[model samples]
Target: MATSESANSVSQVPENCRAPNNPILKLAFKILCIIAVSRESLDHWKDTKNKDWKEHVSIMVNRFQNTNVTAGLVLATTTLFLSSPPPVEHLMAYNSTISYIIAMISFDAALLSVISGSAVLVIYETSTAHKDMETLKHMPRYQVIALLLWLAWPSICLSVATCFLFVAIFIACFGSDNIVVNIITILACVAFLSNGALTLYVFAVVGKKPANGKKNTPTQVIDMHHASIGAACLPR
Candidate 1:
């Protein structure tokens, strides 16, 4: 009798744990289960990779973290400088239209750099907080953030060039023909051209993959049991 009662209790456990009959809730539960299982599988694979290639993995992770922090600081400084309001005399030197346009472009570029820098910092912090296995699960998202951050630098450069263009126009229009002003205008033009060229170079080179000498891919572990359980729990 006791054995039968224990068996009945065990049978009811699955029923108790089952999702509601509502289709939406069932679907949501299934999705959540799949995601959880997927994360587990990824974590297991990460662990395996760390075990098999600890030194290489550590070097790569450290490189990424250092790069992120360095890039974030540079971008944050640039953003702060660009976002600050110019002096009254500087603003008065340019026409209203040119001033407004430069201001808007600078603001937009600054905002983008801030966001990019913030994302990189966040990814670096999060990666550092997690253990090796846990960090691997987030690498894809971090890569995407890094790509956006790289693009933001070029955008900032372009904006800087635009600001310099307006400065050149301002110097050309109302300024005296003094040698000092002429030299400044020439420098501004050179800066604009340099920035434009650098922007083009960045866009061209950003897509190339680093020449990491390793040919062996990391071994991945798939949790078939967890996947099967998740599939079984899903609604027909």
Candidate 2:
């Protein structure tokens, strides 16, 4: 007991004798942590060979969050107003049911986008990843478009649509209303086809990597700041 008291007093005394606090020191500590994290991330990119692949996925995680926010605010407003359908066939099986199911599917997509983006963005934003990309003029717009097209593709998800519930919703809404279903289906098909074609064009344009060490002029897509950090931290 005596030895323990002596040791505690000696060890604890140093802490008790320190100055009240220093704001500058606290800020410096915070900055140091940031720098260390940045350094780690920078090294990570340098080691990878598939720089474009990395960039592609990074942007993907990004768009998810962005589109999610937009969808939430815009679609939610639309849905609220849509509660009062036109005077004719309000709650009946045709238009109302079909439209409702489609609305639900759209809502579900927004949610999934948010979840996917938030999960990755959290890693990119909170961690040292930001440390590396402090400066970059532009990102390859073509690649970004390609990525968006890929993400939009339903084939990758394997099933007819995204998850099972999405498929069910699609089926529920698809055949209910002759006019509404036909119009919506045509619009959706056109959109999918157009976007897919655009993606293919981008790929053809960016057919091969530049032979020499050259990066094309970046066309800013999302946050230039975040993209810059990702680019910088990209390992050699």
Which one wins on lDDT? 1
TM-score of 1: 0.34
Off by over 4 Å in 2: 1-44, 47-65, 73-78, 81-95, 129-192, 209-236
lDDT of 1 by residue, 51-132 (tens): 5445534543454444445444544543444445435434234434555455445545545545654554465446444645
> How many residue pairs clash per model?
0, 8
Model 2: weakest 10-residue lDDT segment is 34-43
| Tens digits of per-residue lDDT for model 2, 1-236 | 85797565444423322212577754543333222222111222222335753664465455545654654554464344345544334222323555566555555554554554455456545533544431111224344233323444322222211333333334444554567765775676677668879976875576466676455556543467678889999999
* Candidate 1 stretches greater than 4 Å from native: 1-92, 131-179, 191-236
* Cα distance off (Å), candidate 2, residue 142: 29
